[model samples]
Target chain A: MDSKLTTTHPMVTADSQSVSSQEEIVLSVQHVKKKIGKKWIIKDVTFEVKAGEIFGFLGPNGAGKTTTIRMLVNLIRPTEGTINICGYDVTKQPEKALAYVGSIVENPEMYPYLTGWENLEHFARMQPGVDEKRIQEVTEIVRLDERIHDKVSKYSLGMRQRLGIAQALLGRPKLLILDEPTNGLDPKGIRDMRIFIRELASQGMAVFVSSHLLSEIQLLCDRVAIVGRGSVIAVGGVTELVEDTQHLVIWELEPQAQGEQILQSIPSIQVLDLESSNLDNDTAASLRPHSIITATPEEYISTTIATLVQAGIQIHNVRKLSPTLEQLFLGVTEGEFIE
Target chain B: MNSIWPLVQNETIKIIKKKRFYVVLLVLLVLVPMFTYAQMRQAQENRTKFGEDWRVELQQAITDNQNSLGSDRVPEEWKKYRRVFVQQMQYYLENDVNPNEPGGVTFTREFLDNSSSLFIPLLIMTIASDLVSAERTGGTIKMLLTRPIRRWKVLLSKLITLTMFVSLIVVSTFIISYVISGAAFGYSGFNIPVFTGFQPGDTGTDMSSVHAIAQWQFILMQMGLIWFVGLTVGLLAFMVSVLVRSTAASIVIMMAALIAGTILTNMAASWSTAKYLFMVNLGLTNYLSGSPAPIEGMTLPFSLGVLAVWALASVIVSFAVFTKRDVLN
Candidate 1:
């Protein structure tokens, strides 16, 4: 927990220093618009991932996440915009721009006839001076050694995904772009990928991960840009966006026979819910004082608890519950929803 | 350059390892012998049907025809056989020549010239038609394009590999046809004379004198001309492969063009410019064979220039289209 405190401090100083140094803008897309026939896939969308950040491109299905990632990797040209990566404009100098980026789009279109190692070797050879040692490192990093020599046609969906990641990691790319890297992964595999991504970020490799998995974004991404229907709706640190509203105060407590009556009697404070489902009577007796209240910070939440005790409700526990990312995501995106 | 080499290697591997490529080679293997055997059989039948010694038969026919003609002699149709017969008798009397000179390189070369309407052209088409279009079907096109290399370089490498294989196939055909036919007809005549430089107006009689060009030199010249046609068709098929998304479509399109060209050359004698089409000029050894030009006055240079134009056009169109076209879904 304390590690989070230290990472934030260093990131702040490094961001400021990088801003002055002009080294932070590893990728910049300014007003990128892509229209396929009559429909726009990515409209005036823009963001940048610095040299060493796990920047999550968070969105729902059909939210232009894949389109944005594709444009960044120069797989598709935008109808109107300039995308610059590693000091080269992607359109003007695509080969050079692409040289700095390693990407995995929709599904990894690997050669099915080739073995997993052969697939990596082929892509590895695509990037010059990328030695066999690097190949081994990437294969090990993605934990594909046991099956690296097996033909890709024999690979399961999850194994193929890992192999795709191994290929992306082969060149030690300055910018690694992954589209839903965990889309088909099991729980353990997702955990491993999250750790691996964090390790890459720790090693100063910036990653652009586009996914609808908001919890993973919150857990893994240092920063995220949220998009919907070809436009970015929100962008910032997860905590900053989620904790912007301080009114929600969640607390837990012990059972009191008159717990509901006591909290309801308090003015301008509403006690939201109580559950006896996961509790014994003794446990319920200890947690029957549970409540959630919405109020200004200046309006003490303790006042509701004090009132409850005075009204003959036994109180054993009370503490604020941190807002889950799901609630925060709902709040941020739902605000954009039309009635 | 390093980035593209891997792509090139993979492309080369894909082409060389494909069963279709080897299948084409195997078909050529079975076919060359079949055609050579069939040609030898037909020549044997002609020998038996006419006479054991074709020269004696030719002299007898010419003497009888002359006696029959008595007053009005040497009609146009008789002129051809008479001239050939007279030459055969003169050759027999002067050098003790025999018309049946035991089939050899000379016989096979002649056999190839007649059989080329279908054999060599089909062999060339089999390899070239599906080179790129097959990649599209295998879903390897997407894998190839997404590599960090430029699109043109990818297509360029494929073209290079195709060119190399085309050369290999052409050279292989010449050697195999020679070796197989040579075994039955022993390779003693390394320096046999063949005719060349037969321009249309050089001889008014249309039956020009056979000046001596060596058998190997003649084969080399014919190979050069066939290679030109093969390269043109290969490049054209490449263009078709680029334009058409399916292997079957590409092969059918090229095959139709080839067949149509042969048919038109046979049937369209009145259409002088038909000689200028790429297909008509594919029979490069026509001058040696002394067949009338498919078009009345079309010369070698004119037909070559036309084929060159089509070849160049296909090259330009393929590169331009392939480099820019959006990939398959």
Candidate 2:
């Protein structure tokens, strides 16, 4: 599209130089690959998260999520390709690239013996404009105000995670990369994290969140990249990917005596099974045959129901069920369907 | 530059906060006096056993033994030993000094000089060997590196901290020993002169056997030499720490090197190259004290050069590997 030709903002501008117009592409990772001892840990991964977007990375265990994050932060050198954060190349200009990003790749490790406030102050001193007020603001934002002065060794797991998030926010980074930020949280904590990330996104901070929980990503992310075996298998808007799966139609028909003849008459209908049969002298003799017919959502609503009724079958109910995102995700990712 | 000041301040605070450091100071405080008292007692016992008029006895023996016989009376080996001893006693007696007098600051000075060979060196080694390794063990190394400064700057800060403590240890030894021993002995030896040229094989009876140097100057020179060796050991340990992640391995490797240096000096004397070992170079004072050097033919210049080489090599390796190595999981 011509819109793609619009001038894009560079990740990092020269010192004391201002741009007239700045686009909001916060992070760009292009064909990054990594190998450890002849085994590819990450392969041909390309994605970008615009400013204020919450991008989700979903994968199973040992699916190279950690390896990919490590490479993104310039903690480990990627064997091939480039990553640009805030307009600086991660490989050639790591310090400048890292200046715009804050990350927690695995466990949030801090000096356990130091107080939370002390740790925050120490890390803040590493960045520009990060003074006592900044520390206080970040601590309050992460909900660590009550326990900010206590030693980290005394903090619980939830408290530690909050502190880690607090540390990540100290520099007011343009891009925040969190790996499984809700791994050890309870339901309430998970909800709080979801809300916190959303607020961060609203504030124009691009958040790259990695998690294995499909529901969590579905709730939190604007878009997701489904990774499998060190490669990205799918990347798009959540609803778009889920809506692409084929639709299914089901009909509930009655009459125990004539069910078989009705099914045999409609050559277009593939009978799944007879769900139930009951004979009642007072009301009616009934049979429900659960039938699955392959058709488009519109075609199924019009043609399948009309065909069943025209066959002299009592079509009590007919419905078109759109496949859920979970089913579509499983089907595309696993290539299997549940009957 | 701003980071350097903070880093140095933090290092100093850490050294001050550790109670173990205070314990080290306390041990030195106790041990210095204990050894000083023992040396004082030995001097007192010498006075009592040899009689209060031992100076007169010593002067009369030299005159009587030489008068009873001709000029060539004593054997060569015995004559040489006695000649050096008799000349030392005469120098003391001529200065109206009882070398056996145990109650003076001069006595403390003498005592500290005697103990420098073993006591001060052992204390120096204990602190110096663990300077860098301890941080690695404590997991503070990572915290330090993650700061917005270069890794070499961190090490340089540690080196500066070590030098300050080294100076503190050496100077404190002088002050504490001088004050405590002065209480019993009195502080008169501050200006006394010490002979510096009495090599083991310079001659059978060289005339320059007792060339005098200021007692204070001699002690300072000794301290400077020992500190140089101690710093070499610390730097080498730092290199080993950078190579081997574990603290214990670095310490053991350095300790083994020190012990091996000492052993090679004794057992491998025939191999002249053994003189190049760090242990042989550690005894820089041996050349000044005119004692039989553990390794023969070791000169002050040669020992200093060897130590310089070792220190230079360790520093090179440390800076090269630490800066470039990837900090991976």
Candidate 3:
């Protein structure tokens, strides 16, 4: 595959300091800052998307993901910073720079009066080299051939989503930015979108997808950037992001208060607060009320269990809880309390 | 700039598909016949009064205006208007040409002159005010601005599209008024001699510059001036559309301004400075018919200058704001 060539040749890159693979960087945002009115909406953000890679941009609400995407497409200007798409600056040379980019910001807002095919044709005319053949190819790529002739006002949300992607791909851009790519899709449609995105990446297109679906990002993206409060807090490989967190094990015991107190008193044991930690709502609620969490390694947990038993604690359950991307996201965006 | 035509085509298709153009045509379709019927009734009333000869009708109208000019009950403004009408009628009678012969060309010329200030600009504003604001309201402006082109070029295309449709609306108004009215008034006056160039208030209806031209030629110049008025109003509406986010609000604002212009033209004669206002200068066809200027010094070139400046300023503001403003939403 064309993507494999990118991974095979590992080269040390310039100052953006991304992964070791030698694929050309398709998008680079350096110290981008945007001030809206008197408030700073995007304080300082920086990252890069390489060719043939699926980059996930993770952030909670008001994290400036949509703003950055608007800047990438030159719909909004960055107050202070440079965003280069392909090789040209998006703000300074939007015609030359945006030529290599396709994006859908908040919604795929096409003219409702126009048909899906007409919308594609309208966008195709703006770029330099797009033609009728390319419009048809994109329509086929998004699997909207059956409904492409219908007016967009009649399209369902999922159909409109597909049409949005079709128009985004009309220019055959090197970089494709999708905000909440799987937002309005059913389970089957979501699976198909995942495969479709993978196919685009395999053809050496850099796909930047901003989503709140952590599991989707974990399964699909090669690398990810987690944004918090208008800045890039962390950027790394998906698996590595999950691996870098502190390990933890859950224990259920009678007189859980005594057991947790005794464990906290022990010099070698570290107790974690399950209630106020807010690691994740589901993860915290899944544990019993009397259960306690400890970050002690398994080999050393035996001593802690013996000591808790001696303190009149009845051991009901003990199991190692693996770290998931959801826990990692909650911890990173909130404060990374696990560390 | 080179690719402006395709963008214009896109805009045109969007408007047509949205049925905005059709609505304008529908309005003309419904209104022209009523006006034509009214004109037919007036012609019938005059026929019974003067019996079959247009010359006799012309003679009687001149006598009536001359009598009104001498009456003390006529306001000074009304007296001035009748005085000019009587002088112009005397010249037409002396030259043996009937100015208001009942026909299709005469109907069109009358309709255009009367509608220039309000009816025609109102139609042009419907399309222009929705040009940019409708896209914003629909949230499609993000898609429009994201294309791989300069922002100014996109706006220029929209301006060009507005100009094209403005011309279409004006030309169609003339055609619709002529064709529909011709059915009732008889289509027989394209080559009839028409008197013009009798400058009101200059040398008391000076017949020295009063020359006779064909009625069709007079109608062509009338259409040309009306088209400029429509284009100027369209540019102002386009500017409002760019500055405002809601299409409905833009339309309302432009409509209010146009209605105010019509009102001001009627009562702003003493304001003096009102002469510089584009609305007061909207009677450009009046220069062709030798009607008194709304405010004393508003000649053809002066009104054209005022409209030109308004159109140019609107263009500058529209482009500056459109290109520089951020798409915050």
Best by DockQ: 3
Please give the range of 10 consecutive residues that has the lowest summed lDDT in model 3 chain A.
A1-10
Superposed by TM-score, candidate 1 places the C-alpha of residue A321 at a distance from the truth, in angstroms, of: 15
Off by over 4 Å in 1: A1-23, A146-150, A184-188, A239-339, B2-8, B43-47, B50-104, B107-131, B134-143, B146-148, B187-189, B197-210, B271-277
Residue pairs in steric clash, candidate 2? Answer: A11-A86, A11-A87, A12-A86, A12-A87, A255-A287, B103-B185, B104-B185, B104-B186, B105-B186
Order by TM-score, highest first: 3, 1, 2
Q: lDDT at A334 for candidate 2?
A: 58
Least well predicted 10-residue stretch by lDDT in candidate 2 chain A:
A1-10
Ranking by lDDT: 3, 1, 2
Kindly report the fnat of each predicted structure, to 2 decimals.
Answer: 0.28, 0.12, 0.74
lDDT of 3 by residue, B17-93 (tens): 88998899999999999999888898899889988888898888888888887888987777777788888777878
Candidate topping lDDT: 3
In model 3, residue pairs whose N, Cα or C atoms come closer than 3 Å (at least 3 residues apart or on different chains), thus clashing, are none
Chain A TM-scores for all candidates read 0.75, 0.73, 0.80
Q: Rate the local accuracy (lDDT) of all candidates.
A: 0.69, 0.67, 0.83
Q: Write the per-residue lDDT of candidate 2 for residues A137-243, one digit (tens) a residue.
A: 99989889999999888999889888888887887888899999998889999999999999998898989999876667878988777776787767777655555
lDDT string for model 3 (A1-339, tens) is 121211112222233235343567888888889999998989878877898999999877677889888888898899998888877788998888888888888888898888999988888877778888888888888889999999999999889988999988988888999999888789988999899999999998999999876678887999888776788777778777766554577888777777777878977667877653335567677888777887665467788778877878899988766655445655455555233
lDDT of 1 by residue, B1-329 (tens): 44455666766666664554676678767877877687678667767867677666556655765565454655544444344444444444454544335556776576567645556667767767777787666655654555566777878877777776767767877777777777777775646665555444323324346455667787787777777777888899889998888989998998898899888876676776677678877776776645446666767777788889999998899999887765524
Which order, best to worst by DockQ? 3, 1, 2
